[model samples]
Target: MSTMAPACGAQQPGNIPTPFDWWPFVAAPIIGGALVYVWTNGIPIINGIVGASGAALGFSTLTGGAAGAASIATLVLYYVLKADGCIRSVPKGANICFSGIVNDTTDENSTAVDILAPFAMGPAGVFDVVVKSTYWHYVTDDSFWVYCDDAGAAMLPCLVKSETACGGHIGSLVGVTVGAIGGVILGYLAAAAVGIAIGCTATGFFYLLCLIIAFIIAAIVAAVVAYAGAVIGGAAGEGIAAAANANDPVVKAWKGLSPGDIVTVQGNWVTDDSLGNNEIFYTTSINRTGNVGSPGPYTTAQADDAIPSDDCNSNSNPPPPR
Candidate 1:
């Protein structure tokens, strides 16, 4: 991932991917889901970060922090790195973007790496992390509760509005809807079992109760199935996409990461925001063209022979002129 930093130096090359990565793509969601269970009781480690953002709509409780950021980052990185064949070269005096939630970022010239990433400055903490992508995936870990995706995070609000909210609200509703359906079924089954023991079907009023029970069971089953189909169906659709791309080249597109273009210091960066007072910026425009010290996934070449590449020298900062 080409960070918005300059003085780009080198480290190790990234690993080439193999077909084996397909497994992680399939297990990503399953494994992540399981962690929620394990850490359900307020992840003691970084629970504070969740409330950092406070609630979004009163419906919001610590957004991207429901599941532990470290947990999600670890799970995601383990799979994504394998899937993407990304490498973590040594901290080349440039390139600083750490994934996962960064909480209490206080380091001085220290290097903090994304646990998923072998490289990406580290030792800092995440206040919270928002995965900006095709889906609204996040974990709120501050004051409210740690949650993931729309289900863990989006479900609560839905449940408040309707017990049967599906589509985006399915995650929250599944528990209530499924539980009620199961309870009704079991209640009917139990009633029938008791009836069989004493032959209550022919007992007039008792027989009428059995008929009502049976009807209620049937109706609930149909409604639960309909709602569930909507929820699981969305997941199945994502599975189709994962299966399709499992063998394709890893899409090395990290957010806002690319090569070739020189980004003027639109932002500030440091080894660790706490590590040193020396924040690194484009004091000079360094040329990455033909500069083998660049990071990947490489974008298409931008300049041709006419353009002169700036050296990673201090003088190059502010590139003397054209």
Candidate 2:
């Protein structure tokens, strides 16, 4: 027997067409998850672009979170992570150890000691001289300071308390931005899908009601997802930073540190981005090599003389750049 052709307006068995295919919505969460993954794991250029864009568009903790649960996270990241950058960076703490001669020491506003040692920045000679004179230097255009490179400085065996301090902040920023964006997308899509399905069964009045309900639900979902994403990003960023600092040997910032001392020192190696293009080792530990009094603090006259002179006649190993 021949089968009768189905009518145009009639629904065929097992051939019902959905007004809207929900499959496309699946990409929302997938793309978002991918962003979070890439950001937390430190995917290079792409993460940077996405993060900056998100911040500009009010989609990140760096800007959007003004007065609610989101704001809480923003404040926490800012104070705790030292999120001082226009684009936030989370500084990771670490420890390091090494032996070197005290080239110069300054206790001006903050106590600090400059050492002349074989730093990973290459055969350690003079940082300023080397950057200007040596063409084969490890210094690159990305150097945090004009004359010094934070990355190379962080690599020095005895320099920083946190080895990841150099570029570590980028990871946190990326994580927060990506996570926030992803969360909003995932939450909105999921909510929209549910809302549409619920609303699809109604006529005009009911549909309008559904639309309102859907919008409200979507807004709530998006906010929650965004908040959760930010928190997760901050946590992940911290973990990554901790992993980097895990094996480094701990040391303290030096106090009463003086010039001409044979010493081993350690501290937080950080770029002073606020003031000038320079790095500082906020010494937390100090060891006078050999006898306890062998490398004692410099005499007042000697210390004054060691102070960098405009004539460039000072004994500073890597003199301040002109």
Candidate 3:
């Protein structure tokens, strides 16, 4: 009787983890595989049908290859245009100026800012504006300068100095051009391979096998081409972003200052009126520069001309000096 009764205590549930916890990892591959199968099968079927029709209508393999290559080229071009900020209107009175060292220049005089025209196309429209930039080094100051213009009209003053452009040259156009050429060449080869696969499929009892083979080959090629394109496009975008960030004056100034450098920032320091006779103020003070100000960086304060006491005292008698 004493052994029959279990120890009297709060019952605890068994610590059994559920299979649902692994659903995400399991489901992702399944979903991805389904999508890949659908996409590969769908694209080839549509493309093969069109290609066969064209072939029957006297379109040679070379022409078909060229057509396929051109499609890839167009896609690359569109991506480049979009990435380069060419698909948007340039802000009024603002000239688009790009600065970077020439990664590949044919001549000695290589300093330049690759100007991009706005997206629109028409007479006097965005794309029509002949945007140009010229780089010059001032011998007297040992500084680099750039001049930007749109249709012969000057925009903002060039703020980026020349020494900063010494980094490796990389830009949207460069990446896109390289990618497009590569994509087209690869696409052409893929189309040729498909044609060969189709021709072989006409042999006896090999149609299903040939189709499967052709599909796998085509899918691999397409994936390679797409991956190359994406990489190129991403590189170009990063280059553009880098170029813009490098040209910012605040960023440049911040870069020039080193750790423990003393800097005097001149600005207003607003305080509650109850603090003293002087509330709104202007002051120059020294602080350790390099992101955060360090202690022992002597800071001085100065008061600005106060608003007339009449304006501040309209509601009630002003308090006497503390």
In every candidate, how many clashes are there?
45, 11, 0
* Candidate 3 colliding pairs: none
Model 1, 78-170: lDDT tens digits are: 432331112222122332221111111112122222111122222111111111111111111111222222111110000001001111122
Q: Give me candidate 2's TM-score against the actual structure.
A: 0.30
Compare the candidates by lDDT and give the number of the best one: 2
lDDT of 3 by residue, 182-272 (tens): 5434544565567564675456598666655544444445445544554454444545555755555433443354422323222222211
Deviation (Å) of 12 in candidate 3: 63
Deviation (Å) of 313 in candidate 1: 23
TM-score of 1: 0.20
- Alpha-carbon runs more than 4 Å astray in model 3: 1-69, 82-172, 188-199, 203-223, 226-230, 233-247, 250-322
Clashes of 3: 0
What are the C-alpha RMSDs, in order, of all predicted structures?
21.9, 24.5, 22.8
Quantify all predictions' global Cα lDDT against the true fold. Answer: 0.27, 0.35, 0.30
The candidate scoring highest on TM-score is 2
What C-alpha lDDT, on a 0 to 100 scale, does residue 55 get in candidate 3?
35
For residue 16, model 2's alpha carbon misses the true position, in angstroms, by: 69
Q: Candidate 2: misplaced stretches above 4 Å? A: 1-178, 186-224, 249-322
Deviation (Å) of 52 in candidate 1? 62
Model 2: how far residue 254 lies from native, Å: 6.6
